[model samples]
Target: MSGRTRLRGRFQLFATLLVTLVQLPTVLWLCWLTRTPLPLAVAVPVSFPYLRQLQSPWHTTAPALSTYLALGWWAACAVFDVLMLPAALAVQAGLPRGVTWGVAGAIALVLGTDSVLGRPRLRKRVVHVEGLSPELDGYRIGQLSDVHCGPHAPESRVSSWVARLNALDLDLVTVTGDLITHGSSHVEAVARALGGLRAKDGAFACMGNHDYFTDGEHLVRELERQGVTVLRNRGVVVQRGGARLYVAGVDDTWTSRHDVARALAKRPEGVPTVLLAHDPDLFPEAQARSVELTLSGHTHGGQLGVPGVRRLSLARFVSRWTAGLYRQGRSWLYVNRGAGTTGPPARLGAPAELAVITLRRA
Candidate 1:
């Protein structure tokens, strides 16, 4: 095997081991609490879905009922462990087990409900640009990102989101990567869903790291066939009335295909530029290049966070550009919370997001 492939395998193995290890304590605790067999409890969570997936290829079109049940159980246990681990520690520190369990369970119940049942809503924001043209003023752009359309986010959910975006009558729609997760089997479904997006200016997208995981090139072609332009280190000019707005996109950063300078090459000198980058970390490069607005969605708004406290989100551990609008000088960055969940298929304070951004001349 190639070095990269071997490294990826190792990484996946490491991650799986780490997750299993983390769940072990909770598994033991639960077994003890409920007087269940420790071996069976551990085996049940550690195997099932994963083993099933390994033993038999996933039927993406219609997942097995047992697989669904296994996934649901595993997800619940993972969330439960995360919620209860601290409480477990507190109990070790001489706190009453009953009180700790009560408090943690209550918190878990509230957050778990939000995570599993919450949906993305249209979030409206107005951005004032210093030198935006009158013709491009009040421009309505719909941003969708990290829509991991697979078992977690089925085609129905994706289609529903597309319908909502179309209903807004947006001037333009931008998807900032991660159209699919799990595998490439659902690429066509996601492409078809995205194809339904209607905007005066049309829909455009940039690749995310996950897309690369599932044949990025193939996904790009499929998106193109569906009438969605997948911009890869390229820029396009959209003329509205008498003014021109430059829209550029770069490849995902994770795959080392991001080239900000290349994406902006040969741009019209005086027109204001907006960059569609999958990772928000590119804001610095785009901002330095004087791009007026940079749209991104990779962090998933920290996916799990406190309702009022932005910094407390789980995404904070990895990215500074968690969600919402950020500005430095004349450059603006807006990170959408994303349309679907990834690994855990859940959301808390940071519900899935569909950004309705209106650009105004300052």
Candidate 2:
């Protein structure tokens, strides 16, 4: 490695060490409160990285009971850090201890309930296209995005989601990427489940940043092997009842694979077209290309926001297109709330989504 790279790695290690050390006080407090021993408390943080490595695809070995217990302890410690730190600070600031504790408890309860019970639900929407043919009007398309199939979103859970999607009787199904996160171990099962989607026009998918991160080429091959089309910067013409609807998808923008022109290349003019992009930020480019409707899902609706209020999402701080349908000029964009969670596997206020969007002639 280059000198700069080596130095960066060393700095990262040092930073991790510092952070872990700083959590010592909180860890001790938690251990005391729960009547746990100090030695075990220390092992939680030390074994967290070890447990993660053991669970990774490269390990090829099952984790032991101790590692599993360590993992749970680490998760509990992490949760305490997130939920109790503010309350602890409030107590230090002369706030009523009971009030502060109550606030923290209420917040934890709310987030816990949301994360555990907020299953993905079917959300329906209608989009009016300016020149949509009668033959293609009322066409239904199911969209599944950000289905991060890993430890948090297991194969069985994703398969169930696909089963529900199949029941919708969609003409076409589009998966807007983020198919897998953390590793490629679950790619085959996830691909097989997605392939089971029943639609007249079939299922198609575009890449997401996580897919690129976790072996994009292998994911494409697996999905293709299961008979699901994976679109990478390309367009295809779908015909039904003597009318044509152009469907296209660009590669993930985050990975620098975004090529709107390339995706829409050689498209016949005046055909109603839809673009499936993982990021809603691409909506401007899609609109510029005169694409009728663009489907996206990357923000997960901030993964924490009030229901029915997309603008209130924390993702709004970074992008205006957090979730929901947005219209500009004659083009429209719909951002799915995503079907899975990343990181903590917790979502508050904002629920997971399985969107079924219908197209109509304006």
Candidate 1 C-alpha error for residue 191, in Å: 1.1
Q: Provide C-alpha RMSD values for all models, in order.
A: 5.2, 5.7
lDDT of 1: 0.81
Scored against the true structure, residue 270 in model 2 reaches a CA lDDT of 95
- Tens digit per residue, CA lDDT, model 1, 1-362: 99865655565566457547745765676677878786555556545455434321223232445444444444445566777768879999999989989877666555555566667878999988887898888999999999999887889999999999999999999999999985788999999999888899999999998898787778888899999998899999999989999989989899899999999996899889889999999999998999999999888888768766777888787689888999999999998999997765656678888998899999
The segments of candidate 2 whose C-alpha lies over 4 angstroms from its true place after superposition are 1-111
Alpha-carbon deviation at 33 in model 2, angstroms: 17
The sequence of per-residue lDDT tens digits that candidate 2 reaches over residues 117-199 is 56797999999999888999899999999999886677888999999999888899999989987577899978988888889
Error of 2 at 149 (Å): 0.5
Question: Which residue window of length 10 is worst by lDDT in model 1?
Answer: 53-62
Identify the candidate with maximal TM-score. 1
Error of 2 at 108 (Å): 7.3
TM per model?
0.75, 0.73
